[model samples]
Target: MQKVRVLIVDDSALVRKVLTTMLESDPGIEVVGTAADPLIARDKIKLLNPDVLTLDVEMPRMDGLTFLDNLMRLRPMPVVMVSTLTERGADVTLRALELGAVDFFTKPPADLANTFMDHAPEICAKVRLAAGAKPRERAAVSKLDVAPRLSADAVLPLAQTPGTRGGTRIIAIGASTGGTEAIRVVLEAMPPTAPPIVITQHIPAAFSGPFAARMDSCSAMRVMEARDGQPIQAGHAYIAPGSQHLLVMWDGAKHVCRLHDGPPVNRHKPAVDVLFRSMVASVGAATIGVLLTGMGDDGARGLGELKEIGAPTLVQDEASSVVWGMPGAAWKAGAANEMLPLDAIAARLLALAHTPVSAAASRVGT
Candidate 1:
């Protein structure tokens, strides 16, 4: 097979050299060229036509974000961001993903050559994944300028008449790539009385805290990192902690969150599959599963299991997803009861949660 051609873009010679060496070690990848700035990188991109580009967040001539905006607008391709592991770096990296970056890696501190060495293999793998990734259409920047408003088309209204049976109301959500922003959009639309929400997102350890905090500040529900044994309750959103497995457990009266330090599932510690599986085992027919935009099929089978148990499942439609892999997989598996756009997801969740238990039970039996 032909090797994946890569272009390295960073102002730092050391970073370029180190990254090039590490990436070249993988026989499947080839370093086509290196550029110290976006202007030079632009010229190189036209000439090299590489399969992927590894970009540094900070550059001399043009910042990575500005370069990214231009690149996506003029000629879109897969780009992976290399960023520092600071809080600011996390924020920028998250934005970069939303701006159409395929993936990101946090470089170790200058003092920690050993740490960088330890993560080199992981970085190399991410580069490979980015090379094979599909580039998403750039999001409309105008949406960012204004606070998002809920459109009638964005939500499905709750059933007006009461049914004989109250329905089981559990929520399962999955996110990756541009999940931070997508999650914020859905969570912000929920009311304070929203049903318990379980979210599985792919994020680094240090960033999850800040991500959750940001969600709490913007959304009506209380948001926090998932703690083992914490009861799942209405008006709360539980985020799977970074680098750990978050599964649902039952304590008879209420559902509890459990954290596991087990091996990574589907190449993600807090994999959507792990959480969805636990929900399948614990809540079964009483669950409502949602598969969101992400880069892989991690949650497809678990969502299928939930569907098999008479639970309703939803997938984010491809047009609105940053990456449609996860939701697409669930849809293909026939796991999703509804396939809707991002804006419609919150309303669907609310409508499902509010369904009477008897009606939900009858639907499950059907």
Candidate 2:
């Protein structure tokens, strides 16, 4: 197989060198060139024609976002952002994703040469995934071996009982890689009074609050970071904090959000499986499980469990996904009862939110 060609763009010489070393460490990747700024990067992009571009979120001469906007509008291709783990960095990185970048790698504030190497595998894997992706399409797979991946059972066991027929219907969503933008699209299309929705997206702690804030600004529904013990309510969407696993639990009167700081499940603290399985226990059949675009199979099993207990499950189709890894896995596992494009998912979810659990159960897999 041909190696993935990459172009590194960063204003800092140290960053460019480090990124070059990291990319070259992977046999599957080849760094074709490096650029000191977006202006230089533009020339390199045309000259090198690299399969993928690893761009600094902040660059000299021209800001990264402006270049990204121009690139996507004119000559679209897969781009991954290298971002600092700062408030401004988070905001800019999120905008980069919106502007069509496939994914991002966050740089820690303190360390560069030492700490950054620890994440070498992650960044290289992201580049490989980005190489095959369409512009604005999220990358689909990650092969980082930083830790032994655990299941939702590590945080909370699969609930064996049937879901209680509910007073309030709940919607649970999980995504990674391309999830931030996909979630934005889904939430923006939701009506003001949609069912209570919970989300888990793979992100850094510094970015979660800003992500929630960004979602709230555009979504008709009230969107916020999930707080431990917060009551789940209609017309509101709760996003899992990047540092915690968000679970929905019954509190005798109503359902509430529960945050867990257990070891990362499937190598993600905010594992989609944990949230999906928690809904299996908390709402059972009253839950509507949806798996959007992501890079792994974290939520596939839990979604299957929801289907077993009579919840309606939907997955975003590949044509509309930035990455089809998660939804494709779930579909193969028989977890999803319906597969729809991104544009149609919100409306279908709105319609399914009102479907009786008994009817939903009967219709699934038919």
Candidate 3:
């Protein structure tokens, strides 16, 4: 197999050097060249024709966002953003994702070299994934790999019993890689009176608040980061904080949000499995699980479990996904009741949300 060719663009020489070393540590990836800014990157892109580009959020000649917009409009390709762990960085990185970047990783504010080195596996893994995620209207072609990881049981017990109470239906969604925009598309189409929605999107801790705010601006339902003990309510959507695992717990009379700061499961702090498993225990068959575009099988097992318990589940089809890893895994495992395109997902979800749980179960795969 051919190695993935990469071009590094950063204003700082140290950053460029560190990123090169970090990415090249993987035998599957090769750093073709480095550029100090987007202007130089433009020239290198034409000359080197690298398979993927690792872009810095801030640069000297031209900012990454501007370049990204121009690139997507003119010549679309997979790009991964490298950003700082700050409010501004978080906001900028989110915008980058909107501009068609496949994914992003935050640069530590301090101890740059050591921190970057420590997360080498993740950085290289993202680049490799990006190489296969051909940006505009294409299915991703890569298979992702990582070190062995703990499952949801590492955070919550699998045998926890669910309450037998009947209540309003709930929607639980999970995504990674190109999730930000896919989620925005889904939420924007939802009505203000839609079922209460819970989301777990793999992201850096600092980015979740801004992500929720961004969704709130466009979505009909109020969107906010989940808070511990917050009551689940309709006309609102809760996003899991990037640092903590968000869980739905039966607080006797009602279900409420619970935040767990447990070790990373499936190599993600807010693993989709943790959230899905929690809903299985808290709401049982009353939940509608939706898995969107993401790399890796973080939510596959939990989604299958939901199906086993008679809950309805769906996944984004590969033709519309930025990376098909998660949803494909679930589909292959026969976990999804339906595999729908991104534009069609919200409508199907709304239809299922209104149907009685028993009727929805009967209507599965229809």
Candidate 4:
């Protein structure tokens, strides 16, 4: 097979050198060229014709976002962003993904020389995966804005009166690629008293905090990065921190979140499969599993397990997905009880959560 050709674009000479060395160390990847900034990277891209480009968020002459916008508009190609591991970096990285970046990595602290050393393998793998990616048409800039837009068809009718106690319901949601915005839409639409939600999105470690904070600010639910031993609560959402696998553990009395630094499963540290599998074991028939828009089949089998255990599973239909890989897997595997468009998912979840216990049980039994 032909080696995956990669071009490194960064303002820092050291970063360019380190990335080139790290990526080239893998037999499957070849360093085609290195550029000091996006301007130089543009020239190199034309000349070298690399399969993938690793871009830095900040640059001297042009910021990564501006460069990315031009690249996607003029000459669409697969690009991965390398961003600093800070709140600002996380925000920019999320925007970069929305702007058409295939993936992103958070650069370790300047003092931690061993950090890149450890992440080299993962970085190389992402470069390989990115090389074969097909770039999506750029969304209108207005559509890319983070602000929420309410759709009449997507709205759930307000409950007339408070219903009596029903059995506890747990929700496990998994997403990637276009997940940031997709999740924002769903969470913002949910009621403040919605059931407990556990989520796993493909994000770097430094990004999770800011991502959770962003969600917290926009949604009624209290969202935070999951901490080991934290008790799950209604109207609260827990996001798995980067580099750790989050699993739900039920002690017959209460459900708790556990964070573990385990090997990457299905090419993701906080893999959707790991969380879905644990939720299947912990919540059984009482859970509602959602497979949202993302790239890859990480959550398919685990969602199948959830369905087999009588959990109501929903998948984002391809028309609404940015990548359609994860949800497509679930739909193809027949794991999804319903395949709905993104705009319809929130309303459906609300309807399902409000279903009477007896009706819910009877529906599950069928």
lDDT of 1 at 31: 96
TM-score winner among the candidates? 2
Tens digit of per-residue lDDT, candidate 2, span 61-174 = 799999999999888999999998899999999999999999998986877887787788878878998887768622212333477879888999886686583556899999
Off by over 4 Å in 1: 1-4, 25-28, 73-75, 110-168, 361-366
Model 4: ten consecutive residues of lowest lDDT: 140-149
lDDT tens readout by residue for model 4, 1-366: 899998999988878877877787777888989999889999989999988989999998999999999999999888989999888888998878778887877788875354675677667767876776566546501111122322111211222322222257878999987788789888988888999999999888888988998899989989999999999999999999988888887756788999877667776778888888777666666778999987778788778877765678899988878677899999998988899998899889888777754556467536
Q: What is the lDDT of residue 243 in candidate 3?
A: 79
Please give, for residues 1-366, the per-residue lDDT of candidate 1 as tens digits: 899999999998878877777778777889999999999999999999999999999888799999998898889999989988788887777778768888888888775444565566567667776776667657601111222332111211222322112234768798886678789889999999899898989988877877888889889999999999998888999999889878877777677899888766676777887787777667766778888887768788778877766677889998887678889988998888789989999998898887764466467525
lDDT of each prediction vs. the true structure?
0.79, 0.89, 0.90, 0.80
Decoy 1 TM-score against native? 0.80
Please give the range of 10 consecutive residues that has the lowest summed lDDT in model 2: 136-145
What are the runs in model 2 whose C-alpha is more than 4 Å off? 137-145
User: Which of candidates 1 and 3 is the stronger one according to TM-score?
Assistant: 3
Candidate 3 achieves a global lDDT of: 0.90
Candidate 1 RMSD computed on C-alpha atoms after optimal superposition onto the true structure: 10.0
Positional deviation of residue 132's Cα in model 3 after best superposition, in angstroms: 0.6
- Each candidate's number of clashing pairs is 8, 2, 0, 0
Task: Look at candidate 2 and tell me the lDDT of residue 310.
Answer: 82
Could you give the candidate ranking by TM-score, starting with the highest? 2, 3, 1, 4
User: TM-scores across all candidates?
Assistant: 0.80, 0.96, 0.95, 0.77
In angstroms, the error of model 1 at 109 is 4.0
